[model samples]
Target chain A: MKIWALQDQVLNPIEQKSIDSFKAAGGNGSLETFGNDPYKQKLRVAIGSPNAPDVFFNWGGGNLKEYVDAGKIADLTPVLDQNPELKNAFIPSVMDGAKIDGKQYGIPMRGMQPVLLFFNKKVFAEAGVQPPKTWDDLLSLVDTFKNKGVQPISLAGSQAWTELMWAEYLLDRIGGPEVFKAIRDNGAAGWKHPAVLESLTKLRELIDRGGFGDNFASVGYDMGGASTIMAQGKAAMHLMGSWEFVNQQDQSPDFVKNGDLGWTAFPAIPGGKGDPSNVVGNASNYYSVTSDSKQLDAAKKFVSTTLHEDSYVQALIDAGDVPAVVGVEDKLAKAPNADYTTWIYNTVKEAKHFQLSWDQDLPADDATFMLTQLQELFLKKVSPEQFVNAVAAR
Target chain B: MQSQRPSSWYAVPAFAFFGLFAALPMVLVVYLSFTSWQGLGTPTFNGVANWSRLISDGEAHASMGRTLLLMVVSWAVQTPIALLIGVWAAGKQRSRAVLSSIFFLPLLLSTAAIALLWQALLDSNFGIFAGGPQFLGDPDIAIYTVVFVISWQYIPFHTLLYQGAARGIPASLYEAAIIDGAGRFGRFFNITLPQLRYTIVTSSILMLVGSLTTFDTVLILTQGGPGTASRIIPLHMYITGFSGFEMGYASAIAVLLVVLGTALSVIVTRATGFRAMSSQQEGS
Candidate 1:
């Protein structure tokens, strides 16, 4: 049986331990791991063809919506019903994000990636600024940084999805979760909402304010291009997911150690209905058994191992992620950064709503078009109205 | 026709391979073009829904237009410089070998490696050329930068071809031209240009098709962003098929692309009067 997973040394020991146990249980399977790529275009083709892997790893959200709607993955609700430990092991909030109409299709397998505003404290201090508490303050800081000859925000503008966090947060804060809920739950017409237009308009304000400097459209998130700007003190802040901190730690340890990297909620926008505390990101990665799996029993058995094991939850914490498993708080205290881990856990815990990334939330086609629109809006290529109309048609 | 015709059996293996791999997939793509399938269930016939949508897809059209622009820009920049260098190098003795090696260096590096190197060099914060233009950033300038990089790598190839073609011209031709009171420009326009037509037509065809199908480099570099400024036809097709999961519409685009390529190659070959320039000249 082919067991596919994303490449990460973080998963090496975990897989070895899991496979060893599976073998001990008289289960024989072969695992093929793709590299630690955020996007798995090849896997899409593989899963559609006859040679689909028995089980595959994925971020649980609208990312799985297509597979679920097409009946490509087995509904795991029955499996969870029989295995209460598996159902109860993962944080309930994170689990909801992976389901469709209360039916579980995937098992939470990895960490929570809540989006946050990561800032350089030294840059803020040097510029006599603090992390913004309101949208206006964030707006002024864009000028403040520009005056100080620094980029206001380090944006990986070329990678449209990287620029997506800004829109996600801004929309949430301005129009409230209902604005996007209608769009996602209601389909493309959600793009035509006044709140979406307002969100796009506000995002433009940040761009026009010189928030992301003149050359932002070229920068990419991979290989530390945008992070380098932040680490090298060329930019004051970066709006990114929790993984940004870990990436910063790896790319420039000194920056992580001494640059006083900081985190904050996206500022509250005036007239926005969204609670400032609400956040957006993947709830957790998941493992789903393919519908066509020849080794159905083995695949289901192997994937359930993702949740119930305490050591697996602890392993995620050690990898610099704040896992959303119940009874894992004590384990988090032993994390790489206990305080940061707590902040992440609580941030996710305290939020009234947690939005999945639109690109990951919407069906694939709309998501692709929506990302293009978002990137275009950020770059001011299309007017906010045009963006909304274009998306609404999708 | 049966008189001394090469045995058809000799072509069987190649024909079988092409039939299974290339011809079969192409047939599937064409058939799939009229259907709706997201790579999940069996493709259901939609009766030109995919084709009709593609006809009005402004983004795909713009991407195709941009690809044509890339072809024009690359051909204009790469072909002339390569021809000039190839002509000059054809007369050189020792430097020709060294120059050829130096010019061919970019071709050795994989597209991914080249993109990474350029990403660093053009990086706004840490790149060596960061202070200059945003090489891969600014949408207005990004496509041209891609064109420039592509030319930087491929000009050497064209140059080598041109060099071979140029050298194949007899020394007696140039010596005869000199005796006829022809100067450098006159001799070149009269002799070299006429002799290198076949090489030029072949390379131009290659450059056009390669530009239209450019994917890996752009995928690694800009990902066809800054509002789709750098999106070429192949990139558009890949994004539509894989990321969008609109495999039917994407297949429509693919079929259209194949048709376009074939039409272009045929038209270009005909218009250019494409013919090989051999040691024994056939009068044009």
Candidate 2:
């Protein structure tokens, strides 16, 4: 049985360690690394190659649908039903995405909150302002930042997904978590919902106010670009993924060293349907065995061992990742944002419902279209009605 | 001892390789263009549907238009500037060596490295050339930067061609012109221009082919962004074929590109008298 682990950057440093561990455990599974940032899209390895990895890493959303439809993955329904103990080990929503037509195809690994507001405490202090908790309050801060000649939010407009963060945040604020789930899940009730359109309209207002950095569209989503604006204290806030915090710690040790980072929940829309707990994210990198693989037994065992409590904790800890396993000892004693992860987990735990990542849950072709449509929305090239209509067309 | 023409049978192996790699694949692409293949499942015959989509699709038209524009921009804009520098560097030994080395520097860098360097250079915030306009972000300015990047890399190749072409012209032509009271401009227009025609046409054709099909540089630089402003056809084909996974649609675009390229090549050949000269046996 040939087993291939299509791993991510978190597993990159300790690849040999995991591989050695797998080998010591008498496994035939081999590991092959893929993307560094799981949130970012990357071209999957070429298909039908002699060296095509049997089991691979895939996003847990509609991306799975594309690959599954392509007939490149193995169905794990039989194994999933047999091992209820294994199924109980990880987050349910994560595994939910891996299931198509009641058949499990992937194992959920690390979970990341892709959209969170990280504000520079020092910048807020200098501006003589409090962290805003309401839509009106944030708008006031926007005015204050404008008066002070600083960008309110350091956004990378060029990054297709980064721009969608605002829309998702606003969706949660206006319609609460239910609306988020409805819209993200492609539920018929949510597509034409006024809350989604209103959310986009509000985001447009922010763009009109120049909340994003000047020429943000040119900036790639990296440590060197708009994220640098926050690290350098040029911007008051950065709404990005949790991975930015991990990367920031790696790149500029001293700049964010103090972990002076403060998180304010995206403000609730005035007279809207949602609560602050309505969140936007999912289990980060989901792993699956290809249906094309000759070795289903080895693939299942490989997943079990790699995600075993002890091995998962060690690997996740070494890589500064949040393990998806239900109960693991929190050994992040020295992690600067250990509290942040805790808060994130707690917030997710308290949420009434989980809204799968909006862009991910949509049809694969629609993912790019939604991102592009939002671009037009931001540029005023398309109105809110037009944006909704365009998505509907897709 | 004549070896019976060295046996045309010896050409079989080379012909076989070409057929296997190129001819067979090209025929397959044509077939694929008329079918719907999602790069995975067995292709379903759709016939003319992909072609019909190509005609109606805004993105497809944009890709073809961009490819043509890039061809014109690189050949018309970059080649002439390169020629000027090449002409200026022709006789001065030290200057030629220095200018030649400087011009060739960009070609040494990998496409990724060149893009990273240019991104830094064109970065709207901290870049050296950032102040006047946000080059990469602005659709208007983005193509120019792409043009500049393509041109900068092509300069050395063009310079070498021009230098060799100028040198290939007979010194006797210049000497005879000088004696006939023809000045430098007269010698150049009457002598240099006519002699370098074949080289210019060949190089321009090469440039046109190259610029039309270029992938790595523009892809890295823009990824066909700022709302597909710099999305050339090849990049469009890539996004459709790879990202969108519409192999048949992408192949249709590819076939159209090949047709466009062949037509342009023919036009260039006739326009530059390349075809006439070759027919007259002036060309080797």
Candidate 3:
């Protein structure tokens, strides 16, 4: 079998061990990995090469959408039909991202919701404050945490993705999916839209109120610095996603487990157009077959086997991912942040709309433009009106 | 001339070097500047469209302006510091070689490695000091950080060049200047400065050219961000071609960079009387 599979973040020790076992079993498969790189312009050179692996991991929205539009990948509707028994194996909306114009072109494999709001249980206990259920409560909690000599949240405001997520949370909770769709589809929002302005204004207030850590703008998202404030109990809450589990697993694994790690939906806006349950993302990352694969059959089989097999699901679970595959609740018993995964899985299962994360769903240029605007606005270089107008013009 | 073939055609080798390395790339770039090509497909002629787009493109112009500013500031910051250090080390013969080698250490390291090292050192988290400045993140300070790192790496190169030139100056001239009551500063300004004109001009030209195309260091340090605050021209071109996937537009920017580089070289050469210095070499 001429087989090659491309995946990102699937090269950890656990996955490496599984690949070795697969090889030892006399399966002829090669794995090529793309490590969380966002620049599709560079990726296209690889995708268009003569020897591109049959199956490669990519983002579902713009990246896969572009490849599908270019006719670079196979329509996996037939594959889904063949595996009718496993039709509901993956989360529906996450799988929806891989579909284009009503045909499934890619299958959901790995997923993560890395930016979650994690509160320090110890801080909460000390301050005798409850995890806020509403946006007003959260705002109040920030002041309470500060009064208790602890920060409320750790924010890498300079990291464009982090800042963009701030806007997305506010949009989902206040402006709703219809408003987001309108704005994304047609730039339809006025500069003075309350939801649009409130998101930026609230973030600025958070900064001014010392909710984010000292020099938070300078820290990287995954680095220990941003997470340190939460991990050390110096902060009461951290707005991050599943990636923090990896950072926490090595230091205080128990803190991540046993109800100490709290996961909540981003707080609701008091007077917003959007529903609070309109979560901010679909599948976080996906793998797809590139256009230049020499071993199409092998590649398709590898993807089919890897994603459908129990071993692969188990392997991914051990690697700190919230797997899209269903019926693996038992395998997740040992997960350090099983509660967080359960919360996301349960919430995603019933969500009415899977709002494609704005940063990844938009055209590459437009998304980059958004990221730039977010950084500029967060740094207070531009006003909220200017930011809204900037994105609208672009 | 020898009875056989004359060896005076050394200029042929020089011309060959320029043809292979410099002239051909220039031709390719100029041609590419006129075509709409995405790195993969066949080139389609687009006339002056790319240039026109670059004219109105705020991002392109901003990046170009930043590139020129970086060149000026990096060279200005690096040259005088390097010259002063070179003179100081040369005066202290015992530690001159050690200090010179240490100073030029950045030159010996790869640009990416140096940039990454500095990034880590300047990182707000887990850097040398607690809460180090956002050298690569904050828009307000990113450009200066980039300049500081660029100058840090280049000072040693120019220092060594100046050191060699200063040592080459005849001791007798310094002795005569000292006898004529020219103090240390006076002797340096009058004797050392006049004699090292060729070395200084050559180094200046090299630095100016090097700064114009500096890519790897700035790329690693910031990737030209906090919203194009520290982005130089080459970086802008790379993003346009590799990130934005607009290879034709990137090529246009590249061609313009060549024009800018050439124009700046001409202006600096005129200002520094570099041609006059070269003529003096021939006359001697």
Candidate 4:
């Protein structure tokens, strides 16, 4: 069997170990990894061709749904039903990411990545301010950072998806996850929801008030532009994924080692409908079997047996990943960067809802259009009303 | 005459290759334009749906406008600088060769490398000009930044063309112009300008069509961002087909590009009388 996964320095070795162990257990397969963008493109082409892999890595939302809808994905409902322990080992919320139409199609394979408000503790200390707990507090802090000659926030606006985190949190806070669920299930008309408009208007006001600063549109996350700015004290805060902690450790070891990295939940909106504990980002990546795999049973066994095993879960924890496996709290606490990892684990465990990123949850065409519109909103090329109207019209 | 011309079989291989690789794919693309395929399974025929969408897509129109602007601005910015440097480099002075070699450095780098290098250098936060104007960020300024980067990358190649043409201008023409009391400016205008006319036409055709198809640089530089400010035709088509998985609509856009490129070359050649070839020396 052939397995495809994303190229990552840390995850690659861990995955290889799992594949090696699977081979030792009388299973056969090799893992091939690719960069993020190229991997997505290659999977789309490969899945429809004769060369499709037996098991492939996927972000488990509308991205996987496309394959499911095409009848190209093997249904894993029976496998989970046959072994309730395998189903119960993973967190229910993260597992639902790959659940479509009440049928299981994928197995959780990696960490939970929830977007958080990460701040430079040293910068916050110099400014004599704490991370905000309310929308109004966030607004005032923006001014405070600007007055101190620091960019209030470091945003990698060159890629629209980075800007998307703000919108995701705001909409979830203001009207709760139901608003986005409507948008996802009902298509473009769902953009007309009042909650979306209100959140975007509020976001626009923040942009106008110089919250992200002027040059954000040029900053990029992948190149370490925004993160470095925040780490070097040029920017006071950065809203990013959990993976950012590892990135900072790699790029600016002194910064992370000094305990200058601080994080918190997104600030609550005044009288918002959603619970403050609700979260958004990638819930977790999954490994889904292709419908046409030659070694279907072995591939299914590989994903189910290897992912939740004691050794595989420990390897993930040691690599700074908070895997979706249930009851790993003590292991996480004993691991490196325990404080941050434990907090994430608890935060996800108690969350009322864990919404997937909208781009990953919506169809490709709508997501692409929404991202462009979102960039225009951030650039002030279009008014909030115009952004809503343009998207709804699509 | 046919017998004297060595068997026609010699041309068979070239025709066969072109037919398979070029002609066949083009026909398939046109067929794809009339069908809906999400880069999966088989395409189902959808008639003129994609064409109708293309006619009304405001984004496509805006992208077309940007592509034309890039072609025009890059041509205007590159032509004069390349011509001047090319003429100067054609001089026999030892310093000219060294300086010319240095100027040709950008041509040595791959498109992706040049784009990534500039992306770092112009990074708004940590770049050389950290606090300066947002060259790659602001929507209004991003497109021009793209044009500037494109010119920086291609001007050296154009300069190489101009340099060769300038050298081929016949030193005898310059000597005669000097004898006729024509100063530097007078000789350049009357002799060099007219002599390099054909080369200018060839370079301009390449420039215009090249800009029309320019993808990787803008893709790597801004990705048509700061809110689709620099999105051009080719990039738009790519995002639609690959990113959005709207292959049918993207094929329609591709067909439009093919038509526009062919028409541009034809118009340029016709307007410049380039088809009427002749020797420009004192005697043919």
**Which stretches of candidate 2 lie above 4 Å from their native place?**
A1-10, A13-19, A35-52, A69-72, A176-192, A329-336, B1-4, B92-94, B278-284
Candidate 2 chain A has its poorest 10 consecutive residues by lDDT at A36-45
Clashes of 1: 2
How does model 3 fare in lDDT? 0.71
Q: Write the per-residue lDDT of candidate 4 for residues A1-394, one digit (tens) a residue.
A: 9999999999989999999999998999999999988998899999968899999999999989999999999999999999999999999989988998899999989899999999999999998999999999999999999999999999999889899999999999999999999888888889899999999999999999999988888888875688999999989889999999999999999999999999999999989988889999999999999999989999999998999999999999999999999999999999999999999999988989999998999888889989998999999888889999999998
For model 4, what is the C-alpha lDDT against the true structure?
Answer: 0.93
lDDT of 1 at A73: 88
Label model 3 with its docking quality class: acceptable
Report the alpha-carbon TM-score of model 2 versus the true structure: 0.91
lDDT (Cα, 0-100) at B263 in candidate 2: 88
Ranking of all candidate structures by their lDDT, best first: 4, 1, 2, 3
DockQ of each: 0.67, 0.40, 0.43, 0.81
Residue-level lDDT tens digits of model 2 in A234-330: 7898887767777677766776777666776667677877767666765456667766566667777776667645765656755676666665436
lDDT of 2 by residue, B113-228 (tens): 88878878887767886656888988677887898888877777887888887777767777889999999889878887778788788889889988888989887888776767
Task: Tally clashes: model 4.
Answer: 0
CA shift at A92, candidate 2, in angstroms?
A: 2.7
Candidate number of the best DockQ = 4
Question: How do these models rank on DockQ, best leading?
Answer: 4, 1, 3, 2
Candidate 3 wrongly placed segments (more than 4 Å)? A1-28, A38-42, A182-198, A251-261, A282-284, A291-294, A334-337, B1-47, B125-138, B278-283
Q: Who wins the TM-score comparison?
A: 4
Q: lDDT of all the models against the reference?
A: 0.83, 0.72, 0.71, 0.93
Best by lDDT: 4
